[model samples]
Target chain A: MRLIAIFFGLIFLLVGFRNNQSIELIFPSSWPEPIYNDDNYPLNEQKVELGRALFFDPQLSSDNTISCASCHSPYNAFTHVDHQLSHGINDRIGTRNSPAIFNLAWQKDLMWDGAIHHVDAQALAPINHPDEMGSSINEIVQKLNKDVRYKKAFKSIYSDDLITGERVLKLLGQFMISLVSCDSKYDRVMSGKDKFDEQEKRGYELFCKNCSECHKEPLFSDYSFRNNGLEPDPQLKDIGRMKITQNRMDSLKFKVPSLRNIEFTFPYMHDGRYKKLTEVIDHYDRKIHFSNTLDPILEKGIHFTTNEKVDLVAFLLTLTDKNFMFAPEHGYPKDFFDQK
Target chain B: MIRSIQILILFFSLGVRAQDSIPVKVMYDRFEIQPGKTILFQDDSIRIDVVKFYLTNVVVGGSELSSGLLFDLEKDQNYLLIPISQIDEIQFTLGVDSLTNSNGISGGILDPIHGMYWSWQSGYINFKLEGIHFENGIAEEFNFHIGGFLNGYNCERRIQLQGSSNVSRLELDLYQMLQTLSTDQLKKIMSPGKRAMDLADILADSFFLR
Candidate 1:
């Protein structure tokens, strides 16, 4: 085993010498360590660029219409805002809303129900969903293998043009792991770079007191599944975590999404029932339908006056990192695709 | 230093050592299964288009042969050269375990591109048997994509078989698996659940050392 390790080590160094496009994860030092480790899955600039191109390419779908960016647009923190529930190819509607994608390196589980445990494997869900992309990794790889551009890109990175499901999925994972959103107003305030105004200050206190338990600070989420007291939609009848676990206690429990970029990633919640951030606050304030699996912290129903509600919204708005949403590198790779 | 040398020696002498290994040939019954060929079974005839299964943690003579070996009877040769002299007892899991499922995507036979993986959910289809099952002069298609790694629903079964030194084959009776299925299970099984678990048990039970 040691001999093999040394042999592989020599090959790794030789490969590393050939490729000088390796990148590093850049985020606030004060933030907790991201769950994604670079030991097994290293970050590379070329691979990330390849992943970004795949992210925006519609060829990934069965009919070559819907891409990952169709629902997860970079402008809306990688989430669609036009529809409450996400729609896909042939105008077919999915059951749940498309959640925002940022700071995913810290996320332990993907999707509202925490079904996908790995970031690399998360793309399979929508890609294979009949209502969504309606495509398989096998089908996508066959198409990608035929494309000269994909062949060239893969050859440049892997030193060969062999495109497989593992490479495609891992490349997508590389791009997702690269998405780090820490430069919010709240982050600046915490770092002593900026100060909150009177209204914002009061709202921050309320958030810390009431919301911080589940939507924990720093990352803005503890990444635990919880029934935050949204009454189950009669039509959807989506039994969130229970579908995965098959346990009665996990019924109606969905993953607590990060509130970062909360201003843009609306229609909120698992089913996207709440449209505005104000409506989301109002749900907690008044409309929390108690159930057996409802989050115990929200059982008592925190009462915030209209004035306090406005202040809370003010603080929530500060969580938006405009730089992340509008990052030129994160946008559609027009130049990459426009090339002959 | 000693361990490193031992490993280097073991690696270099693998080809020489493999001569002593036992060759285990897989069979449908008394005959080898040919893809796309109609075969007689009890009172009916069935044509197997695809028969794929994962034989994981293949242990022969207390030595593990492979971590996971995906067997595609249509695509692969119907034999395994297990790296052991004589098999007193052989033990292996009939499906990919929960640990591999939780670890996510991997390369080689475990890759999701093999079509053994479920895209909507995160798991591998341990045993995939798709064929036309003929019953009472009626032809019907059957697709049993059995797999689940979740608690209470995990379909992987640890199977052990005892054999003498002369035993050169392991036979799996597809007819036995067909007998275990109910009318509802004869059509299709796409997802993991109680039904998949039941089918996995039947698939595991179908194998015997000869």
Candidate 2:
């Protein structure tokens, strides 16, 4: 841990410590430190508020109809439940499902294929995608510069009215990192505030034996890329991590998404193939595609009884943090937007 | 004793200011670089629409002094000021380093608003050259946006040049560089790979101290 801190400190020093202030990350004491350090862009209330406003604003899209929340709504733990693939501006469907947006500080890489290395730069992907917002950071900066509200906010927060792409991206990153979801029933159970019933306890044991290797506890993700034995889609032909790495060994590999709020953040999988927990479990049980790059853990298909699947799903529901989903701060900043 | 201490402080300040800083200048030659300006070569006439690249890790006398600088042929901001006086040996990378590319978003020349950053991926476009080449009355467009940080696909080039006496400028023959690039394999290289690495090597070979 000391070595990691020193490494992060060296990086901060090398970058010349661009920002002077720092924000303290508040998570469970037992949870590991986030890979993302706050030294890059110091998180403050005003910056997060600006980011929240930008997230919900339709002006971010080229046609001024779509926003980040268009796909990632807070009510559904920041993932869209209405569709399998993400629907962007002009009703264009994207290739992959929009992943949920909580506990982002823990994620060293974003996107299903783990293309984006940092949360600060992740928004640029969807914002500039032709199927997504179809807007550039340059375009957004120009529009925001003209807005009186934004000008005032920028002046107050940054000590100047100048709005640059760096400030805009950092603000969005701050808002995302502020979304900490560690207040679920599972957390309460771990804290000894509550106890799981008989079926749920059995499900937890099964999960520890099988799923815990990849989907580690607390964060519920080891965050490594793996091929979880799914047949390649003929149309998408999305060779996943291979596209980034240009290596055949990395074929079909995708980042292991955190299972926190798994009950709400579905349909499951990178393509959102399954709509129910039982269907996902059945896929693990009966359908495991063998390939050279397939994860060794899923080589022998998991065999779970029908009753066991039901109990497993019951335990998975304990991960849903309703408090986080309904948090006023995480939602659209109505007060900021309503001022106009 | 206090007066002697004051004189010692003055001498120390003078010693600190004695080291001279020089501005690194990029001098282009053997080409008219304005948009749509035709440069007729053997059997082909090329019209360059855009040319931009990142110059980073400016080293003088084996010591690195600068981080990164974006250079656009159409823009007037062509020189980078560095804290070095002598021009004995100079070394610089033709693109942003892999470390900086992975370190996330930053301000100024490294900002995404500059249009050099790849929106789909998380790396800066190391070198961008877009143009139309005419061969046998046939005009084909070519875009070479070279960048990739991972191993086996890294396109950043480390270039070393023997500097002239008291001269801190580097001259690159743009026509020679373009001539060296075969038109057959020059169409739409927007991603990092073997082709991008090849182009980076060809471009890096074209730099010399002036």
Candidate 3:
């Protein structure tokens, strides 16, 4: 009996030890399991804290003028709102609009064109891009190595003071994965905690009828590449998915961005062509350009009444999670920067 | 007591067997067509600055050997040292397999920090050969980064070499590849496509057992 008790105790202890190794990814029960394999990069508080610090620090950039947070601010749903296109180092404008950086654990590919397959390698694009940070991982590592704060942070987490590109990228990924925004009014309504207003209810009905196929429920995105019939800009003849696949069928098919927090992430689409939700609705309603590889769903233009359009816009506003936007934990680590 | 003694002897024998296996060294030597200071192909004089590629799924004698290794001509440290005996036949892929390319945040040779990985596109640059070739008294740079793991554009090549040795020295002659292409038509190939696939084919053919 004593031996049996000891064996059971040991089993319980082992289970507890395994549970402590991984930090749970806080997400709604309704959502599907995240595509990112947590085993590759197990979540921990120390790593997440280190990642958050790195995200706000401009030292990652060549000129130390731009950080990941420069384009992806906390207040604006982690996306730049002041400009249509993303402004990189030295005031150089990027081709595409900066997408929101929330609920990224669910996403399979990053960027407008689905160029980056993994979230871990996504930071390398902007870091190496001449117009963006204009910096290399080697330069960033050198800078981080010199900093006492970074050295101490890395030592605490990894139990050693060594800082490598893999460590930096993985830690940054941890911070990104922690940016979960599931506390919106829409989420509340789905959870049976709150009820939608009459306007919002009508908007939800219209959204389900017209846009739910692509702008899916729960996540508000199917996350597939589709050419929604926007006329090709002569200046920036940016063929989206075709650039990667080199397939003619994939021409102009950009990743369908999530409509969550659309109220704040203004200047929509890949190129930031539409400034207003009404304009986006207008485009969907009347102005769908026919193409060889255009999405079949968008072939028959979605016709929306002006009143219905107003209701849809009202429904979209419910997606704005104020708690996530203004969360003190997600914001710039003031104590960390202040100490330095 | 007799069973314990037998187990100890078995363990000792296994340890001795493990130590007896020799480490197979895979060496890479880069060379031009002509044996001289300056690398010359046809009329244009060139210089080979760098040559790097990934060797994956290395199988010897119809059995699995080394999983993968990165070989860089510029770096002396980049070489495979496999602990295997009697290499009768060798088969390996020139580029990274599709599985490793899709698998995120791998360590060692496949790490993104190695500079072999394509940041924009989530795939490894299977083969990278960069150098400067002078054309009409003007120095023109040539960079061929071969990679594409997707269907239809998969540039990974399967190479089978017949050899049996503990230490195999593979010779890559850059001159033979340069001879086929004109300086004007093929200056640089950064992204993966038909051009990259064609150049990779040339690179695979350039390898010879020495």
DockQ for each numbered candidate: 0.44, 0.46, 0.43
- Per-candidate count of clashing residue pairs (backbone under 3 Å): 0, 0, 0
Runs of candidate 1 with Cα error greater than 4 angstroms are A1-14, B1-49, B61-63, B66-68, B83-89, B131-143, B183-190, B193-195
Q: Write the per-residue lDDT of candidate 3 for residues A1-340, one digit (tens) a residue.
A: 4555687799788656644656778888889998888775678877888899999999988999999999999998999886878988999988888999988888988889889887778888888888789898778988999998988888766647988888898888889988888999999999999999999999999999999999997889989999999999998889999999888999999999899988989989998999999999999999999999989998999999999999999999999999999999899997787766
Query: Per-candidate TM vs. native?
Result: 0.87, 0.88, 0.87
Question: Global CA lDDT of candidate 1, please?
Answer: 0.85
- Two-way DockQ contest, 2 vs 3, winner: 2
The complex in candidate 2 yields a DockQ of 0.46
What shift in Å separates residue B177 of candidate 3 from its native position after superposition?
2.7
Candidate 2 lDDT, B1-210, residue by residue in tens: 566667768889886633454533333354436655777767778888788888888887766764556878777546655556668887888988888887778888888999988888888898888888787888888788989886578888998888667685565556545664464565888877887888788788877766
Would candidate 2 be rated incorrect, acceptable, medium or high by CAPRI criteria? acceptable
Between candidates 1 and 2, the one scoring higher on lDDT is 1
Writing each residue's lDDT as its tens digit, candidate 3 over B145-190 gives: 8897774677888887766565355455665467645734767888
